[model samples]
Structure formats: C-alpha cells, structure tokens
Target: MRLTPDNDLTARAFARLDARLTRETERPVALALSGGGDSIALLRLATDWARARGRRVLALTIDHRLNVESGGWTAFAGEAARAAGANWRGLIWDGDKPQTGLTAAARAARHELIADAAREAGARVVLFAHTADDIAEADLMRAQGSTLGRVREWSPSPAWPQGRGLMLLRPLLGERRGVLRNWLAGQGADWIEDPANADPRFGRSRARQALAGAAPQAMDDARAQVGGRPTMDGEAMARVARDIGARTLAAALVCVGGGVTPPRGARLQGLTARLKAGEDFAATLCGARVEAASDGVRIMREAGELGRSGVVPLVLAPGVEAVWDGRFAFRAEQAGWSVVAARGRLASLSDADRAWINRLPAATRGAWPVLVRDAGLAPVLASEGIERRALVVERLRLALDETTHEDDLISATR
Candidate 1:
C-alpha cells in the first residue's frame, strides 16, 4: 500500500499484455474505462504500451445511467482517455431498468454496449482491469453459496454475437486493488469511486467486507474438461458418449439453444445420463431442442420456444449488423431488413436452396434463422448483398476443444 510509483509494476503489467497485443494485427486496442481506480490504471498502462508500439488506443465507457453520477463518470472517462492521448466513446445503456437482478442486468448491458462499441471501432481485443482482489471476492461469494464462475486472465467476450469476434484481456489479474490504487496515487492520478462497490445489499460488497480481515485462499488451477463439437451426429455422439459429461452437454445445449444461461443442474444431469445411455430420445432444455435419432444427436435452437422465451425477431436498419437468436450474425446492406425464424418460410427458398435446407436435420431446419426484406421479397440466404455467419456455432465448437485458448477462439472467429 505504499504511495510510490513502481517501475517494476509497470514493466510487469506490460510484460503480461505485450505478447497478447503483439499477436493482433494493427487494429486499435480497446479498453473499458469505468473511471474507477482499476480501469484507470489499465487505461494508463495500455496507453503507454500502445504509444510505444505506435498503435492507437480506444477507451470506451458505458453510462448505465442508473445513478445520478453516471453521466459525470462517462465525462470523466472521456477526459481521462483524451489526456492519455487515446480516442474515447461514451455508450449509454438507455432502456427500462429491471426492478430486480439489477446488478446482473447492468453487467449484461455493460458487456453488450462495450462489445458493440469495440467491434465497431475495429478492435479485436478489449482490455479489462480485473485484479486479484476481485477474484478473491468472487471466491468468497462462491464459498457463501453464490454460483459465480471463475474469471480467467484471457477469455472471449461474454456477450454473444455482439462480442462474437472480440477477446477480453485481463492483464492485472495478478495485481491487487490496493497496489493499483497506490500506483495511481503515486502518479498523481484521481479516479471516481462508485458507491455501488460498497453497497452492502450487493453480494460482492458483502464478500469484500467479510474478507477485509481474512487472507484469500489459494485458488486451484483445475478445470473441468467439457469439450465437444457444436453439433454431434449419431456416430460422433456415440464416439464421445462414454466421455461426455453433464457440463459438456449443458454447454452444447446453451450454445446451440442460443440462450445465455445454462439449464438447471439437476435436469442437466438427468439429460446427460439419458444421452449417455445411448438411447434414441428427444428433449428440450433452455430453449434448445436435443434429439437423438438414427441420424444422430442434433441440438438446435427451438424456434417455437423462442416466443415463449421472449426472443423476438431482430430489426436491422440499412448498413447495420446484429445477432439474431444469439446464433447468427447478420449485416443488412439494404433498407427495411429483419431476421426471423425460417420455420414456415422454407418454401420461399429456391429449389437448390430448399434441397440444401432439406438435408439438414428436420428439427433444426425450422429453427434456422433467415434474413428477410419488408417488401415481401424472396428469402435471403446469406447472399444478394446480405452477410450472415453462424458465429455462435463456431465459438461453441472452439470452446468445446480443450486445447483452444479463449484468445485463439476469438482469432479463429475473426
């Protein structure tokens, strides 16, 4: 907690991130600047690193607008970014705030906004300032019965199609909050402290207070091997049936289902057991339809379940891009375009296209997403000035491979 700028600290931070940055092309590096001590330190370090390499830096701040001070924070972030000789953008989470689960909702909004902004800015990697203290706090929360997941030093962006091709880098994961704040203080830098960090109603804040007087436990490096192809045919399913676990199956369901959350643990376990038994069966979980037939086990987004799950067609303006059903990323080149499930519209496709669509599993064809024009035009099939990619399936396939790093997954998608 010494108030002295440690050159070793800067060197260490740069060392941790240099290799990762070097692997990217000449595109600008993006950072999520929250105006907090951790993110401010990241901005400073990343700016220095980028400047030395003659690269540009883009700092993005999300104005959740939940607090009266949010606007000021975004302004502060802009000023800070400019002072650091970096470009700045302010994104707003402008919508109705939920009455409950506000923290989770805010986090989701933050990720989506940041991912969209970073991708739009031509950045393939976004930097975050998660420190060792945050990891300890998460561990404590999990110990207290919270189902928090582990945070890695590098990972793909959590937001779906918006974060499709973006990788998240956490260079400060080995650093501590106090050390970062001390370094910022020594540099004569100031930052805004969000009151929410200390709000006791939040689990993170409570965990922080509880750990104030305790030492953090050493975290384990063990990881569950939950890898599989995006879609497994009957032969492939049988090949991995003996090795497939509930965690792996659940991930497939979530990925193919185009849903964010995974299925309940107990139900997932039951389904895993049934699938392992190697019997022909059909089941739906978390908005995904999983069927095991003579053809194989095909898991796909349940188009009929979308309305019940509150997923609506995505409306896109000209020159705009969006992800529909969290499965496909679509870019609209013409005006008045939208994306919807292709259930009843299969007949509108050309004969050749219909033949190709018919070859796919019968249950999956209906749930396939297709682009449409407002003028009662022919069904678009990733051609004719429209671009569509199944990025979710690609990510799932990469994620299921145990050897694939999150960084490699992003690069592969790009």
Candidate 2:
C-alpha cells in the first residue's frame, strides 16, 4: 500500500496491531466500530491488514438505544464496516435503561455487548480506536475528581465472564484524534458525530471543551503494581507488602466478588490495614466475602449479594453458552441442562463430589454452581456434555500479574 502522509497513520497503526497479533494470528479479529472518525479509520486499517494476511475482520457496533439517532448510528457503522470489507454485527442494548448513571451504565453495556458479540464470532482480541485525545480527556476528567483510571495501550476487557478470554487492543492510542479525522477525510470518508460528545452535562464533554485548541499530551506507560494468585486461598496473599497487598486485595475482591468495579479509597485501605496487622475478622466488599483467619485470608463471593443482585439459575439449551453470576462460563452440549447454586443440594451430591466440595472453604461451596439434568443433579467437574469453566480467577490473575506485559498474549483462561 502507498503511504501518503495521511495513509502513514494506517501503516503505523497496522504495525502496532501486527506486533500484538503474535498469537492467534489465524483467528478472525474484531473491532468496535462506532461510526466515529477514529473507529472508521481503524476499520479501514484493520480490514486492509486482515485482508493482506488472509484473515477475517468482524466489526461490532453496539446500539445502546439511548438517543433517537442511535439506530441511525448503528446502521452507519454497519455500512462502514461492510464498505471496509469486514463482517458487521449490530448488537442492541435492549430493555429498561437506568435513570441515573446512564453514561457508566451505557459504557458497561457496550463492553458486555461487544465482548459477547466478539466471542460469539470466534474473535479473542477486540480493537478499540481510543487515541491520545481520549487519554488527555480522561486525565482532565480525573483531575476534576472523576474516578476514571488511566487507559492503557492494551488491557483485558472490563466485562466479566462474557469478556473472560478477551483482550482489548488500542493500537492507535499514540495517535491524535485530529490526525485520524484528517486521514479519514483524505480517504473521502465520513462519520457520525454523537451529540453527547459535545453535551456539557457529560464529564467527557466538559473535559473536551476545557482542552479545546490545546495539543494532546503524551501519556505515561505506568502499569499497576497489583499482583495476586489465580485462586481464592487467602493464605497466599497474607504476607504481601502493605501497598501491594492493598492493591491485590482490591483486585481479589472484585474478581471473587464478581463485581466489575474494584473497591477503592478509605474502605479498601482500612481493610488492607486490618489484614496487614494480622487481625482475624470477616467482612464484605464489592459483593465478595473477605475473611482474615489464622489459617490465612480467604475471599469468596457473598452468596446473599447474588440474591440481592437478582441472579437466578441459568438455563442453557443444547449447543448454547451463557455466563452465570459473572463467574462461570457454561456451555451445554446435551439437551437438558440448568445451573443452580450447590448450597442446599450438597447432601444429594455423589460422595466423591461432596468430598471435593468439602475441600473448598465453607463459605464458597454454597455459591458454587452445580449442573442439573432433569430432576437429578450432576457434578459440575465431572458432568458429561456440560462444559463448565471458571472465568474470573485466571483472568484476575492475568490482570494483576506483573509478569504479564502489554505485549504478552492474553490467552483464554478456559
């Protein structure tokens, strides 16, 4: 491909993407195309790269259905993806929308929808078009007391089990928004400008306005020092240093608690302090129970929170897959399958299964999902035609592992 000044952006971005696709190069790559300048530019670049490599590109657009024009935007995204020679999938955020915290909720919904769509399409890496301008805006928001964390060049998808094995790549994070828009214009392409981006009511809009006419600042490459094991055993984390322990505990709580957001600020510090001081106590944070005992600290999902959160038994049909309670990814290969908590049914379990369940912490055993066929219960670990996989534990480990760098391939936790 010829590299004009405008087209050079595509070359550079493609190189970044190429570096990240060291593994899974044969798999179809997916991108989140929002009909915006950056994403449209990404679509073209990704399609070109995929085409040259004889790989396929899956472009996913999420319709949050928040604005009247969202349907039009999704259509635009689909058309853009098809024009770029990529397969397009439109996902809808159906049902009732939250009255408050709409932005956060919409973002969460977008991630979940995109992750599900990408996974369903057999793609493990999802490309995002976040640029330097986004990092600057995020920094401005954080300076103005927003709790947004720093955006990295590569990171795990934020959505739980649905995003279990997925990695998000921001190949254009080093590029500027204006440069990408110029490149798109050079190609005679157009994109939708969401009115919400300029609405002052949103923090991002206010930040964008505040940074108007200013050059985008370069972002630092600092990684979180958080570290943790892939299991729920508390003893493994007992002797960790204070600051590291606090960070690890936060990640552990979020993972084991099955919550997307990690606990922060004073409460987390207090809990870390107590644990560091060797205090034996039990507490709950982010829907996960944390117990610091003489045996060590054990963290598990708080079963009551599951009920309060309205999580129920998951029913799966043959050849269907679903995530249960944000923890396990369950796939049914047989006709009859349902996953329910193992709490009251422990006595009915086979002696061998019961023994295995007994080995786990008492608090965790009740919340463990057990497979059911008709009226009889089957051991999740030993069941036939039912593929049960724990998602959060290994994912959390990868997210918190210091050895896992941005360049490392985030293989599927399953």
Candidate 3:
C-alpha cells in the first residue's frame, strides 16, 4: 500500500469528499467541530475549500456540558472557525442528563441539537470529522463485543429534519488521525485534549489505548460495499439482500423504536428469518413490536415500552416543534395543547377514525401521541399532521436503510 504524505492527506481527503458534494446545492454546509485535532483540520480545510467555491460553511461546536472546560473549548472552536473565515455557532446540550447510558444519551442529544441548528440555518448537510483511526478504534471495540457499527461517510441525520433530508457527511473517515494531527502541527495549530479520552472508563478510551500496540489493519476505502437501507413494503417487510437486509431492519427498528442500541444479533436474525418465512408472528425486540399479518408486517413502538421508557408528556406552547418517544417528530399550533398517547381516546374517534385506529395493532396504539386541549381531544391526526409525521418517520427509516450499505462496506474493510 502506498502512503499519502502528511501534507497531502488533507487535500486528498477533501478531493474524495468533493465528489460527494457535487449534488449539494445548499448555500451553507454545517460542520460539527469539537476543537480537537481532527475537527479543527476539517474546519480549516472545509473553510478554505468553501471559500474558493463561493460556498458558505457553518462550523458548530457542541458544548455537551459534561465538563467544566466545555464552555472554554466551544469558545475556542468558535474563534478558530471565525478566524478561518467561516460562520460559527456554539450549541449547548442543556437538559436533565441521564444518570445511566450517559454516552448514548449525549450522542442522541448532540445529533438532535446539531441537526436542529443546521435546519434552522437552511443547511441540508452536516459534516463530522471522524477519521480512519476512529474506525480502527471502533473496529477494535466491536471485536471486544461492542455492537456499535462502522461509521459511514454519509448518513441521514439520526435526528428529525435530517431524517427528512439533512445528511451527515464524514469527509475525513478515510484519513488517519495521526496524519491530520501532523498536518495541524505543521500549520502551527494547537488542539485541546478532553480528559475523558484518557479516563479509561469509556470503551473509546480503552480502544484508543489498545490502538497504540495493535497491528495496523489494511484501511480500505471506508465507502465501499454499499447495501440497502431498511424499509417496510405496504404490509410486508421489503425484501432486501440477506446481509444488508438484516442490518437495515435492525437499524430501522432501533431508530423507530427509540432504542438506544440496536437489537441483539440473534434476535435480529430470528426476526429476519420469520419475516422471510412469511409466517404470521408478533414479537417485541429493541422496544419495537414487529407484527406479521396476512397483508404485511408492521414495526412500531410497543405501547407498554413507551411508559417504561420514561418519555415525559410534552406540552406544545404554540408554534413549537418537539420530538416525542424519540420516534415521532411533531409541531403544534399556538398553546393549550399536550401530546400523549391516544390511549382511551381510541374509542372516542369518529367511525372513520375508529376504523383507522382499529387498523393499528393493539400494542402499538399507545405509541401514537394525540393532541389534547380545552379538556378534550384535539384534532391533531385529523389535521393530517399525523400523515406528515409518518412521512418523516418513514423517510428516516429509509435514510437508515440507504446508509446500511455503507455500514456493510465499513465492516467488510474491518
């Protein structure tokens, strides 16, 4: 294998990325910068490239609020972006932090916040600075029984609007971390190291430590062996190629079911087998209930799991949009409304609505949030907002499915 000189890696990485950007007509692209070496390099390279092309790039730093230095880091990132002649914004993950699964929660929150910002800015794509070394680390982690999948060059933003159309592009996934840092050093640029990176408590930290002595594996193009994304066909599960189909289905279930992680391998395989057998069955896996009917199989959040998941009821104070159950994205008109499961109200709908409600599996009924105002049920579903929400949800599932091929490619290289 030939080596790319440290100085040329950045340009080479961008050259690879430029081909992917040909169809991007969005005025400004969003970059998620962490003030770390990889992201800083990306910010610099992207800024220069965007400027030459007369395109705008927005560099966003997320302050996860997990450490005291987070604010300082974000501020520094903002300054770096501005100095590089790019627009900058600092997003904060402000909310009640989860006591358990903090990393996963933080990741979800981070993407949601970033996607929201990108959408607000009219940008359809967000860039991340993950590198080849990160993929190696993830590979090591997976070998050690981690289910975390390969990082793809491009994916649908796991969050709302992006699930609709916003894309997450990782331009540096083919470049090595050391090469990026070397380039940064050559430019006399400095970066901040998060203490958590060396804390050893995190799996990532352990993987990083392991990489020090691990034999280097051939780093093939991270963007190879594309597979199909997940999708439901009418009432039946869509037929996808075996290997990719399972992965796409798993991703779709996890994304739609609001699970922090994908379903276990054995269970996923079993579900796929059942789907392929064309047998009638119903089972709950990874917070989602898969029901195989004569017409088709429907994958939805299990009603019982919703309450257990501790998804608090959201009150929309007019013109505000919120994601519920991590599955449904909703926006409501001005004030006096609370969104919760249809529950008992399923019986109160008009005959037509009743028929529609009855079509939903029993276990999935409570998974749908209905609007309530003025001591009565509000016409949320009647307003066709439910259809729009469903469209977004389906789009997100397709996005995950479309990216599953990339995941397959990454896995093959590993």
Clashing pairs in 2: 234-297
TM-score of every candidate relative to the true structure: 0.85, 0.86, 0.80
In terms of lDDT, the best-performing candidate is 2
Please report the TM-score between candidate 1 and the true structure. Answer: 0.85
Better of 2 and 3 by TM-score: 2
Which residue runs does candidate 1 get wrong by more than 4 Å? 1-7, 23-25, 219-224, 227-242, 277-280, 293-296, 310-316, 336-338, 347-351, 371-383, 397-414
| Superposition TM-score, candidate 2 onto the true structure | 0.86
Residue 274 lDDT, candidate 3, scale 0-100: 78
CA lDDT, every model vs. true structure:
0.75, 0.77, 0.70
Q: How many Å off is the CA of 320 in candidate 2?
A: 2.1
Question: Model 1, range 1-414, lDDT digits (tens) per residue?
Answer: 234456588899888877677543567888999999999999999998888777789999999989998889899999999999999999999979999988888998999999989988888788999988888999888878876667777666778767776778889988878788889988899999999889999999998887774555554442444544344442112123433666667667777777777675578888877777777887889888877666556676666787566667788777776777877777777778888777888999888878877776676677776767784887755567777666654656544543333245443221
lDDT for each residue of candidate 2 in 345-385, tens digit (9 for 90 to 100)? 78878888899888876766777788877756454545777
Model 3 TM-score, all chains together: 0.80
lDDT of 3 at 321: 57
Candidate 3's C-alpha runs over 4 A off are 1-7, 22-26, 65-68, 94-106, 159-164, 213-244, 255-260, 276-279, 293-296, 307-313, 360-366, 377-380, 384-387, 391-394, 401-414
Structure candidate 1, residue pairs in collision: 227-400, 234-296
Q: Write candidate 3's Cα lDDT for 1-414 as tens digits.
A: 223348677577667557556433556888999999889999888887786666789988889999998889999998999998989999889878999888878988888888878878977678899987788898989899987766777776766443445667888887777777778887898888889988899999999987874445666543343345445533212323333566667766776676546766788888888777777877888888777777656677788877777777777655655656665556666566666776656766567766776676678776677666654654344453322144424444444534432222111000
Worst 10 residues of 1 by lDDT: 234-243
